[model samples]
Structures are given as structure tokens and as C-alpha cells.
Target: MTYSQERNKKMHSLLYKQRVLLEHTGKSSVFISNDSHKYYTNLLEYIEGDLERNIYTIPVLRKAIKTDSYEHLLKVVQFFSSNTSCLFDVKYCYELENMEYEDIQADEYTNYILYGTEPVTANGSEIEDFNPKYLSFYCIINMD
Candidate 1:
């Protein structure tokens, strides 16, 4: 089978598994099994390194994320997808700071304490904080 075909097959399998898990748990989102998460994390790390070097594209990256076999796959995919150019740029490592943790408490009595505030925007307004320098690099390669 071709590379594209293999990727498609993997994506399909992942989606199927996610659907089954959701149905069984009655949850709308995907939830990876503990063992699956550990297994997939190692796989994802390798794939992500390749992606950073521009050895992969959006579709291939999407397949990798879809086939993650872990709950963290969605977040990993989003992070890489959002910064495709960063793969080639070694100077800028993608970072997400101050992410709000998802609520897991089963009790209904506790009020949800919103931990993080959403960024707001005003018409024709700009906000800039330049403490952390951000840079990305890319290179042209000829495959012959």
C-alpha cells in the first residue's frame, strides 16, 4: 500500500476507536485508555519531530493526530497543526502557557471556578507583550 493509503487506514481506525469509546462512556469527546496514551505518546513524539522538519504536511499531520490512540492526541495535533512552519524553524519552539485544566470533579454541588480568563478584543485595538521572543526558521530542500 502507498503511504497515503496507509495514513488513511490509520485515521479510519482511530476514528472508529474514538467513536466506540465515546459510545461506551456516553461522552461526546474522545477519551484514550491509559495504556493507549503511553503507547501513542512515544509514537507521536517521533512523528512530531519529523513534522517540525517539514517532512510532513497538514494532511499527514492530521492523520497522525487522528490516529493518536490517546486523549492527548487532540491537543498535540492542534499544537503542531497551528505551527506547521515551526517544524522547519528550530529557533522557535511552540509553547502554550497558562492553559486551564479541565474540570474532572463528579460532584454537582461545587460551583465551577473559572481558572483562566478568555482574551478579549476591541474593535481596532491591539495588545502586545514582547517579553518572550518568538522566532521561526524554514529552509528550501530539493528532492531529486
Candidate 2:
């Protein structure tokens, strides 16, 4: 597979596992709170230069939560699945080396190498690097 295709498949697998874990842990679904909305709004605005330029909007999230429909989040995930390169942090992409689709589906430890939510630190300091461009298109939709 091409680099982008491999990356996209790996990401899909990670998200699938995460959702399964969330389901088993009694969480009905991930919710986007007010703070999350604000954070994502800022991130999207920075990346896209304007949220208006994108198809997604802040109000859409508000409406989803109100109506108890997570279709918006699903759509975002679908977009991310296809545009993994746009949302992935290129700096850490080296970790993806040698990971095939089959291995990703079979390995329970894929999270540690991929999108692990737990903080990773170096020299007693936390490091954060989120891909801004298309991340605004998807992850903010979860923001739990």
C-alpha cells in the first residue's frame, strides 16, 4: 500500500479499538462539551484561517448533542479515515514503519504506537503535537 493508504488504515484500526473500549467501559458515546467546542473552534480557525471556509460548523456540534445524534461525529471520522495524512502529525509518522493492516487489526498494543491518548513525556516534560490542518475536520468531533 502507499504511505498515505497505510497510515489511513492504521488510524482506522486504532479508532475502532478505541470505540470498542469506550463501549465496554459504560460510556454511551463521546460528547463534545462547551470547552471542547471552544478549543476545536480555535484550532479549526487557526488551521483553516476561518471556520466558515470548512463544511463543518460549531453549531452542527451543538445540534448533534441536543438531538442525541452522533452522525456528525461519524461523518468526521469517515473524513479522517480517508484523509489520514492531512490530520496526522508528520513528525511522529516514523513510528508507522513496518505496520501492516493485518498487524494493526491483530495487535492489542497498537494504541501505544499510534494515537494513544495518554501523555508521552521526555526529560520530565510533556510533549504535545497535534496535526492542525485536517485535525479540525475530525478529532474535535469527538473531543471527549
Candidate 3:
């Protein structure tokens, strides 16, 4: 198949998997699995010199949070699909049954949290200390 055709097929599969995950979990948002850490690390290493970035650094994160977490995942997939030869996959996307917030944050896949908070406008008012809950996203990026 052509590159575009293959990308489209992968995108379709991603959407289907996300839909199934939403239905099974009864949650409006879905995140990539934590098991995909190495892939993300590899992606960061390819994009930057080190794994110093996280999902929040993505330019689309702010916009994605305004909608739903799943939207962020879609945008991320679309970005890699259109811009690079990397194959992004969420085959390991699954809920962490007993993981703690601290544990999740410390995970190599999500260790990219900024130490400071930025003022965020909420309900038409600017909240100085708005700490919004973030959904973790992890996916495999097979650089071809």
C-alpha cells in the first residue's frame, strides 16, 4: 500500500480501538497505555536530545484539554502520521488498576511535568493556581 493509504488504515484502527476502550470503560477520555514508555522515550530522543519532554509540551495539549483527552491522542497520532515515517500504535492502551498519581507522574513515560503552574482561565475567570488533572498518554513510535 501507498504511504497515505497505510497511514489511513492505521488511523482507522486507532479510532476503532479508542471507541472500544471508551465503551468498555464508560469514560469520555482515553489515554495511551503506560507500557508504551520506551516508545515515547525513543520518540523524544529522536525529536530532542533527551527524554526531557512530555505530553504537555505538545502544542496541541492545551487545545486538546479544552475538548477531551482522547482528542489529544488523535492529534498526536495524526501529527506523526502526516509528518514522519514513524508508526504510532496504542496496542498497550489499558487502564492502570492500582497505580497512584505520584507513581504515574514519576513514570518515565510521563516524567515531563513542568514544576510551575500557569494561570488558566476557567468559567470566564482567570484562576491563578488552576491545576487541571492531566491524562497520561503513552504510545509506540516505530521510526521507520
Q: Which candidate should be chosen as best, given lDDT against the real structure?
A: 3
- How well is each residue in 1-144 modelled by candidate 3, as lDDT tens digits? 987666556555644453454344333223334443323333333433222222333334333233344544455454444333234433211123374222222232222344343322222233333333433445453433
RMSD of each: 15.6, 14.8, 16.1
Please report how far candidate 3 places residue 18 from its true position, in Å: 0.7
* Predictions in order: lDDT: 0.33, 0.33, 0.37
Cα deviation of 13 in candidate 2 (Å)? 1.0
Q: Residues 86-130, candidate 2, lDDT per residue (tens digit)?
A: 332111111222641111121222344366543332232323453
lDDT digits (tens) for residues 1-144 of candidate 1: 987666555545543443443345433223335444543344344453343233443335345545533335534433322332122211112122473212122121111123322221222122234122221111221111
Q: Where does model 3 exceed 4 Å of error? A: 27-56, 67-144
Stretches of candidate 1 off by over 4 Å are 27-144
Cα error, residue 57 of model 1, in Å, equals: 15
Model 3 backbone overlap count:
0
Error of 1 at 15 (Å): 0.5
Candidate 2: segments with Cα more than 4 A from true spot = 27-144
TM-score of candidate 3 to 2 decimals = 0.30
C-alpha-based local distance difference test score of model 3 = 0.37
RMSD of 1: 15.6
